[model samples]
Target: MERNPWSLGWIVLMCLFVTNRARELKVEQVGPDNEAVYNHTLATTLVEYASAVYISDMTELFSWTCSRCDGLTEGFEIIELIFDVEHCLQAYVGVATNLNAIVIAFRGTQEHSIQNWIQDLYWKQLDINYPGMPDAMVHHGFYSAYHNTTIRPCVLNGIKRAQEIYGDLNIMVTGHSMGGAMASFCGLDLTVNHEAKSVQVVTFGQPRIGNTVFASYYSQLVPNTIRVTNDHDIVPHLPPYYTLFPQKTYHHFPREVWLHNVGLGSLIYPIEKICDGSGEDPSCSRSVTGNSIADHLIYYGVKLGGETWGSCKIVMDQRLAKFGSKDLGGNFVFSKNPASLLQAGSETGSISI
Candidate 1:
């Protein structure tokens, strides 16, 4: 074995060549083209809506300010974005004549607030701290239970205090990510309980909760709720499975009223029926299911410019057990343009997983 040093050198060179080729192959497997992460383009498209809502809320808040009005006040409320410790939630608040009470509660979950918090704190660039770094950190339900529980009550209490003092004044609820979810829940509660028909909610990237029964209950309970989910925004499609099925009911709005398809219906069926079979390998199957769901939520929203009311409406008709439908795209929201990505998905693969 020690006879030829030249032979040993040849063997080492051959090993190095093989290792280099293997490395290249692995890179290809995880590269952008093969294992790429699809982002939502809806944010940009829906910025106008976001800005409009923000401005409208601001206008109303400003109108509420009365320097001499006994309980009225005006100032920037510092929101400590808990998800990203660096930034704080800053809002232009016009407190109506309620010096001794809390009015107009602003609530949200983690994804909404955290992202805003990070942006506020300018810490989003530091997404390198984790293993998957930014992408590996799954942001399905941005804020965990701790954040949700803590924030929701504070917001409710603030609203209660304000309502008590202001008597007939209005309550405006809003949030970006998880904050949006918190706002939605609070709005749902207020509307359901008959606290106020004036409860206005404007949320971005909001998640789904409860079951169809809950959805229906809220629809009846809170009609003024306006949730704007950007095309393919994944965070909005949460509360994945309906636990109490047979007894529980489901509710879907008119096609022209929904914000996005949400991918919940389409992706769930395929993932559960096909990819998640016994014959498939565990890892591959899981990836297909997870990615498909993620793709449905995020990419679909992104593609549709934060508008899915029409698509969702169509999906609802097909998905509902008893509801009979006449046409698929009859209530379609946007103009059927060939250049639109949403249309492209429908023709080829659909925005579902």
Candidate 2:
């Protein structure tokens, strides 16, 4: 069978288009300090724990009482759970006894519905700068959600408490989608302000959080940042990264692990591509059509968000029955003095940023 000349020409033109795009993108390789390697086991494990944070009962999470958290929290000790009423943000800090590390997981906007988050991304609301980084301009809403929310103080309190109790262990910060954006902010906060020793940030399906300047400054601040995006995951494409207008467009920080299917026909094979240090590598997920919202829900066969995992409201089983209201969540002891985390203050973990 002879192929049509028109079809062959079209294929050649498409190839040229792809090749030109790749050449235009800045695909820089990170230095040894960046620690941008992908760890399959770790990524899978962390996402599960991140999903477990969706447990609505703050008390259950603090006590490590939720059955949903059982698989993820086997050796993890829940320290604090913050459900910010005003902004509707949920996050929790816990100590992984096995790893001897402090894990901070932020629950994404899935509570409100993923569509709302995606629709909000269509706006071009850029903020001025990220604290000390004067040139780093970020998304206004993401910056405020992290810096201005009640979740900030509560998270800090939790980290401080963990430090006081267990000493300065490693900090692993992670989340999915909107949670991922917050995770990046939290990692930066721990790095500059808190004087945290070791901080690692891994986010899944995270949107472009800031402008080009902000992405650079964030890389310098928190070098150990990994962004995982699935093929056709639309969130990463939002606020739109324009090659010609990068300074004005929203950009992501390196490095990104793109999960894509390379299978032919019905074979259905998937691969994890650890992209170049440039967060906007054109050859990676940026090469595909990012229009599938369905691709945003799963990473490494781990289904995240939606009605399937939303039934933890009752929180039945052994731990809940064991505590039974007598033991309230006193895990994180907040200090009145903003500087102090070791010395106990009021039970209320609220502070202005």
TM-score of 1: 0.35
Question: Which candidate ranks first by lDDT, i.e. highest?
Answer: 2
lDDT of each: 0.32, 0.72
> RMSD, model 2, all Cα superposed?
9.1
1-353: candidate 2 lDDT, tens digit per residue: 99887676667656644643443211122345655556666676688777777666544455555555666457577676666655667787878876568899997774455776688788766766777787778887877888887778879988888888888888989988888899999999988998886888888889888988888888878887789898999988887888898787888889888888663334444566778777889989899988988888877766666453322232223323222222133222212222222323344343221
Clashing residue pairs in all predictions, respectively, total 30, 0
Badly placed stretches (over 4 Å) of model 2 are 1-33, 306-353
